[model samples]
Target: MVSRKTLAGAVAVVGLLVSAQGANALSIKEALAATYQNNPTLNASRAQLRATDEGVPQALAGWRPTITASGRYGYSWENQRGTYFEHANYAASISVTQPLFRGFRTVNSTRQAESIVRAQREDLRVAEQNALFQAATSYMDVIRDTALVSLRRSDLKFQEEQVRASKDRFNVGEGTRTDVSQAESGRARAQSALNTSLANLNTSRAIFRQVIGIDPKNLSARTNVTSLLPKTVSSAISIGQEEHPSIQSSLFMVDAAQFAVKTAQGVLLPSADLLGEASLTDSNATGNLGPESRSATIYGRVTIPIYQSGSEYSAVRQAKEDLGRTEILVDVSRDSIRAQAISSWGQLNASIASITAAEAQVAAARLALEGVIEEQRVGQRTTLDVLDTQSDLVDARVTLVTAQRDRVVAAYQVLSSIGRLDYDNLGLSGARYDPTEHYRLVRDKWIGLRTPDGR
Candidate 1:
């Protein structure tokens, strides 16, 4: 008869095997840090943010004076009354033009640029959150699939042993041939399941590499992010609307679009500028004349726009339409964020319940399987009964593992929905990318071809 001690030993062996495999496991925090540093999508978003930083300088250029220098050298020939003459002339000029007024166009344009830069910063934040969430999900997936593979392999081994035992019993006239055939069929199904699980593990590993930027090693189970989540769904939605990067970015975009409308309206107003020029000219002819002259001038210029084939008015109308569209987009972003928060909150709650139920199921299945094995040894239970109980135990254990993985992933999803999945909130240890430092370095910079860090 199968004793309780024997079943307990079997459980201990499985535990030891899992523990040995996890000795070199990678933690979730380390995986997130690696993704933050190496993810191509996140890095691309940062590069785009840096590119947006240049918009401020481009806008500020409108308020600064422009200086230009030009030089021309030419030869001239003329023929009159059968006589030919040749002359060479050289002229050089330097000019400066400073904008005195432009109906606040530069001011509104600068405001627009600044607003856009702020929006892009929020976009970068969103990208970071997404990358971290993906890494966490992939990490959980690998752990779940790995555990399933191990469970399936163990089940296959048990089924193979059951088939051998049934055959021996049938040969000795203690078991029927039908019992041996059932055992063999169960073993075949277990083998198939193991193959499927191995394939799933490979797929999970591929995704882990794609998201985490490296091959997955022994991955440890991670603590859930439930502590970082809101206590209630209402609070989660409130926080998401207030702090979600997508919503924040949309708000800034609305502001930028408003400024763009003002900038377009400014085009209809008069513009004024101060202009200064200095020039030197030299002329020489082969016959007898050579003259050199220098001149300087400073003046104020005013330009008033009257008509332009209706293009300027059309531009103002277009800008206003764009502003309206952006305002609507702000609403859209809020609705989308709210929905995500609610859905993620629901998922988290469901996963918690599933884990609870799965744990109970595993415990019950284990006891049932042990009882069946004990009964079969005393001829009370058939071989088919034992095989069915074992299969139930394997499935229950797999369900429990899957539920645990879902719980972890769902918690992270909740954090991400409310914009708290970033490195700062997670307390990930790494070199955080600071967008403000780059903005500060380049915002007022007058002249430099290279970036602040000499990139």
Candidate 2:
């Protein structure tokens, strides 16, 4: 039979293994920071925001003067009255046009661009939150699966010893062959469970790498975000409606669409501009006639739209329709964010409750298993009873691990739902991403081929 001291030694070894793993653990904050800095999807969103920033300068360009320069040179030969003649002419001119009025198109277009940029900034925030949440989920999954694998392996070891004990008893006629066969079956099942747990651990690790841009290394147990969550679901939904990135982005979109309607309306109005031109021309004649001339002129011009095949009117109607759509989308975004907040809040609460229940279950199962083992030693319980109790203990440990993981992941989900899963709120230490800096750099910039950082 397996000695009690041997079983205790095995348990101590497993505890030491767990302790060693904890000693080199990575914190959730460090994982989130790595994800924020390296996640491909989040970085792509940042790049997209930078692209949107150019719209402001494009709209502002409408207010600036346009200058054009042209030069032409030509040689010609002609026969007149049976006499051959050759002439060469060269001309160069520069023209400038500055818009004095464009029916407020520039103003409305600039406003629209500004609103769109702000919307894109919110979009980036959404991406950041999503990436961080995914990273946190994957991190917790790894931890959970790793613990389950360890538990399964330990269970398998105990079952292997049980099988040996049963065989030794049967050889001495103290136990039946049925007891040996049952122990062997239990050991095989434990091995299968361990294999499954290992496979799950590998899958979780792959997800961790994909989300965080690095393989998980000694990940520590993550602290629950209960301290960061709102006290009530109603409060969470309220915060979500007010601060969620999706809702904020949609609100900005509505503003942009409204300005778009104004810009489209401006297209129907007259445009006025100041125009100036300067030119130089040189001409040579074969009959000893050559001349050079220079001229400069400045004038104000107005262009009144008379007919455009109803295109301008159609554009105005389209803009109005778009405005209506955007206004409706704002409400849609609000509803979706609110729903997410409520669902996540419920999940967080459920997981917390589950953790508490699982803890109690683990304690009860541990005591039951110890009682069964002692009863078996006293010949009051069969070997199968002891094996069954050990299996129950392993199952209880697995449930506890899963509940812990769920609690951590659900907490992050709640934060994400309310739009608080960000570096600032989490107090993560790193270079904070600021979209406004790029916008300010390019908003009023008249001319630049390079970005703010010279990229």
Candidate 3:
């Protein structure tokens, strides 16, 4: 019992391997907001998603017209029937080609690009959830470590008082040498334990800073996300399997791969294009000049593929196999998400029970410690007995502190495992980042050198 709190706090501190701002310890929502706004991982993922946004326009390019201009000039000297002549020739042409048909490759390729964009958006969602989870865990760890340090200090103070009382009684010839020695030894150990707890608190504070982008202050710790979770574990699993971003992303990948197979198969079909061209040519000699000539023409072109070494067939087969892989991955993601929901649900229930048990144990230990101290004063108990009881009280209080932290952390885990731990779900205050805004801005874009935000 004396060692349990020390072990729990020590473990949490070691894991902290990163706090809070303002008057009160930051609430879970506020910390989540901070992470959402400033975390590098989340921001980078958003940027990556934005890059994916351009794929739609690129795919749509297959349906657009291509225009080109060319100009050529040449000079020549020739002798004809004893007469020397110098001639110069120049030509200029402009042409435009609009795709009339492309075996439906453009349509399928565009659909595939759109599907990839959707998948990347889900990837962004996963990043957001991960950052928020880290922030919440770090916040709770700081609170637990801080409470353990306070309890350690109080226990140290109690031990110091015991040492002084034992010394006074021994000077008055009432307490034995063994009692004084035990009291002094217990006081030393308590001091050492307090130092260890302080170190743990410092470690937890460092981790808090790393995750939440701030140092820990007097972080208050009262909020849990139980309301965001489903009422039953099975419900949680069902929700997770349905709503988790990993599953959604993988499903979108299946869609993209299906479209890709079609796009590749389209390669074997004929393509048609309508083209228009205009040209002007002029010729001049050293002593003779010719009138400039102008010409214009419009034409329709078709390209029929007649088996070029089976590359397109290979591509079609490869795309079909990739589609199969993506479909299997969808099941993989769903299975992982289901497991996560069940494990988080179990942890939440266990934490709730532990908290209740720890509270009762703390109350009983405090009463026992008081009784032991009074008995020591009345010559019915020894200094060592009082030290032992006080240690038990501190351990009980530490257990309660750790259990409370666990309860809050477990609630958030349940929320995350079910794919409900996000800015909107938590109802965080601030401007939410809308990925669709970027996707819409870039999807149909024809020409641009800079981003929508002018960057």
The C-alpha TM-scores of every prediction are: 0.93, 0.93, 0.87
The runs of at least 3 residues in candidate 2 whose Cα sits more than 4 Å from the true structure, single-residue gaps closed, are 2-24, 222-224, 287-289, 378-380
Q: Would you list the C-alpha lDDT of every candidate in the order shown? A: 0.87, 0.86, 0.83
- lDDT tens readout by residue for model 2, 1-455: 55666555434422321233565678888899999999999999999999999999999999999999999999888898999888898999999999999999999999999999999999999999999999999988887787777678778888888998888878888889889889999999999998998999899999999999988998776464678999899999999998999999999999999999999999889999999999999989886767899999999999999989999999999999999999999989998998899888888788779878877887787678778877876788898898888877777677677777787788899999999999899988779888888888888898779898888
Clashing residue pair totals per candidate (backbone < 3 A): 1, 0, 8
- Better candidate number, 1 or 3, judged by lDDT: 1
lDDT for each residue of candidate 3 in 1-455, tens digit (9 for 90 to 100)? 13334434433431221123356656667778888888888899999999999999999999999999999999989999999888898999999999989999999999999999999998888989888988899888877887677667667666666777888899999999998899889889988998998898788888778777877665666564776778899999989988999899999999999999999999999999999999999989887796699999999999999988999999999999999999999989998999998988898899889878977887787668767766776889888787787777677777777877888888888888888889889988878999999888888888889999999
Model 1 alpha-carbon miss at residue 30, Å: 1.8
- The list of candidate 3 runs beyond 4 A from truth reads 1-25, 72-90, 174-181, 281-293
Clashing pairs in 3: 18-206, 18-207, 18-208, 18-209, 18-210, 19-214, 25-219, 25-220
Give the higher-lDDT candidate: 1 or 2: 1
Q: lDDT for model 3, please.
A: 0.83
Candidate 1, pairs of clashing residues: 25-218
Please report how far candidate 3 places residue 36 from its true position, in Å.
2.6
Backbone collision tally, model 1: 1
